[model samples]
Target: MASNTNLTPPRGLEGLDLLASAIIILDDDNRVVYANPAAEHLLESSVKALSQLRFTEMFLNADSLNAVFRQATENLFADWRQDLTLERSGREPLHVHCIVSALDKPGMAILIELRENVQQLKLDREERLLDQSQANKELIRNLAHEIKNPLGGIRGAAQLLELELPERHLKELREYTQVIVKEADRLQTLVDRLLAPHRRPHIVGDVNIHEVFERVRSLITAEFPSGLAIKRDYDLSIPEFRGDKEQLIQAVLNIAHNAAQALAPRIAAGDAQLIFQTRIARQVTLAKVRYRLALDLHIIDNGPGIPPEIQDRIFYPLVSGREGGSGLGLTLAQTFVQQHMGVIECASRPGCTDFRILIPLP
Candidate 1:
């Protein structure tokens, strides 16, 4: 047993620490005897604190889960596997695939493991997102390249025609030339933005993510001086990593800006809320690469959530939910984060939208 463990975990329980899924041990009486570190995160409590309560006390759906535990204990060498929704107070319900098996060992009568039911689905979705992001960036860059040459020609021709206009019709015809000039310039600007991510030099340096968060927080607060509330829950233990601070700031700011825009109605009623939360994630997998530690930054907003139909495609270029939106905010943000070898995922419901950015740490 590890000397620092808050609870007297049984011998050999140390093996459980390596698993990514949550694992808990229950005595014959269904009281918590041990919980691995992953379980501590899932339950949001320490092993010592959880030891005081029975396993059933941890969840709203305890009765049914306890029934499974009882069955496993009664039928020696028996095990059960089933999908379950673990509803806990003050937190979101978890949909997991639960397994309960009778353990012959003393003090640890039953072994219970909970794995996210959507684990496979999440992996597939992440792969698809990466593929889609890559294709979108390539297409945008190519299209911008094709558009750039014609735009210069159109603008220059419009300028030349404005100068060459006849004296009699100069006033009327020159206005039409000016329109062409302005519209060409606008499209040219748009093309430049499309190529910006690919063309910009990626500057890498030591990044303290909290500093980035504070910068974004100040920007949002200044923009929405009233009604919107910015709340922060920072994990001060997060270590500095190598990344581009300015790019991170821009990526976070874009998401926050969109969140503030979505909170317009709630802001008007003086109840808008946007929260910034940071935590140190352990043994996380990002972009198919596993890292011992990673930075988990979540930006949450209490606003009318993204429309379900467009949620899946929100990262695609020019996919905006708001009226008059340019729709490039999320696409650019995703691009910048990807540049840092990280992934950004969004989950939203009617009253909440959570944008999580995961970046590997040193």
Candidate 2:
């Protein structure tokens, strides 16, 4: 029952939309012609809205864009590269490593490529790392000071309520207090999870990524215990990279856990398979560096899959698709990996979901 409308987009443009990179196309007059999905999201607007604005209207430093636009138009060239700062309303301006080129069959149209602001992105990453470091410390202290006492009280109340009521009524009264006790326990667990990353000391060393994958596989199997398979398609020749082994383990573990959770029903149906794929990528960009070599690790699952509603915000803190999920796992994973100058990206459809992590090789 597939619709045959030929809706599949041209491969290059489609790939651009899926990428975390921002892209914009401009005409000879420097008018906005196209803005990819990432650019639209980054700018907090749509292609339609962006199309109404000139390159100057969107980019705080329009001169560089204008200069390049003129050059491409005058020379009929196919490519240009520069780093420029882009300013959007409300948000602080962003620095972008830009690539521009005239389209083959074009009077004025030019392709615009964007990479994240290296300096700003680096500062933001470090600032968030510091913020998370401090936040976790406060989270631990506050949770210890605040959660434990109330949780004890709630559990105590449930036990006392069971003693006071008649047997039949005891179940109901205990259940009420039990709800409070359970929630408090869940909150305590969540606080611990949030504090875990910050509490650990860095265990820096050369890490074989496949070993990390094997560890994740073992851990996931121990948890799932039934009806799930961890399939590996690895290129074992990838070189060892400098990193915190335990942290990378935790990062990969978190992502695998989410995939396993998503595959729960499929596991029950005996149709679930989660795959670990590793390969070496060349000329790859992560947090904006065009590294000569990068580690490409993929975790793919065949499950019911993630809904589209919250896909864009999946890496944001405290977002989860599961009931009672603390939602801190993926957020923490992203934070941890990003600390090592890496990126984690996800793609999902009806029965398949994939999370890819790319880190520069050292």
Candidate 3:
């Protein structure tokens, strides 16, 4: 372990020392020889403090990196390597990807990149859940199909039976038929909703994202003309995207609509503002793909903001923060965006709320 501390290092080491992602370099003994600014912030300790500690104290294992970490290390070839999870705050684990490299001398250097573990776990769990939900949807669709054929026969049979029965008995039999019909209709509605995502043909073409935003703006204004303001902050330089225009409209609408709802009280106070902005981002990654041409769209609202309790499940089906909400809008929006190989992320604070959507162009 290198014990010497350089409060003011050279520019190269200084650059890595200031990264936002958690970064730490360990010697052959796994002692914290050099810890960066990001690592200090991530671990809630300064480099001076971290320099005296061992990596094993923070990471579960340092002697032999786990299979996941080993594979990641091999892939990056030490240009930058990291693949590990650390438990902090005595709470949930954090997923991190790291970049490793050999120092100019004999020791090793590692850079830790942080990612939201909850999101990763949620994605993994939801993948299995999506399969289950898909199966249930298919079953419901088939069942609805099967019931439609027999529903008419059953209703007709009840009518015929009613005619043959006493007037008093006819009423009771008719009620039974009505019950069956009503229940079937209710199931039919659910089936239609479940099948809606799959049945809608994907319309792929060059989409004018600004046009979609304009449509959303007009619709929101139509719905909430009073006490609510819609603002546009678009980057004209952004090019057309390859996507379904209607689906993108709905996807953006759902989020914008949610923002409007959250701004209800503020809208009533005549203090609500919703901003729609677009920009071109370079070296952006969406749905795990690094793309040079990326469209960045942000829906910002000045409102109370989403409650912390339900923020994590905002994209989940049937989960809503508002009463009487079907809770499928955001879920469907997420589904649509994911299909376009894009990502939708939300960040909320007391006075500001932002929903960012990133999609590839060309």
Q: TM-score of each candidate?
A: 0.69, 0.60, 0.65
How big is the positional error of residue 240 in model 2, measured in Å on the Cα after superposition?
3.9
Candidate 1's residue-wise lDDT over 55-75, tens digit each? 888888878776778778888
RMSD of each: 12.5, 9.0, 7.2
Query: Per-residue CA lDDT of candidate 2, range 39-135, in tens?
Result: 7777778777776767677755576567777777676566877776677667887777888877643433666777877766764654554465456
Weakest ten-residue segment in model 2 by summed lDDT: 1-10
Error of 2 at 216 (Å): 2.5
lDDT to native, each model: 0.88, 0.76, 0.72
lDDT of model 1, residue 281: 88
Per-residue lDDT tens digits for candidate 3, residues 82-198, read: 456665546556666655544543444433445435545645544654564456446646865786667567656756665687777877777776776677566556556645767
Which stretch of 10 consecutive residues in model 3 shows the poorest summed lDDT?
104-113
Candidate that beats the other on TM-score, 2 or 3, i.e. the better one: 3
Per-model clash counts, in order, read: 0, 0, 8
Candidate 1: lDDT over CA atoms? 0.88
Backbone clash total for model 2 is 0
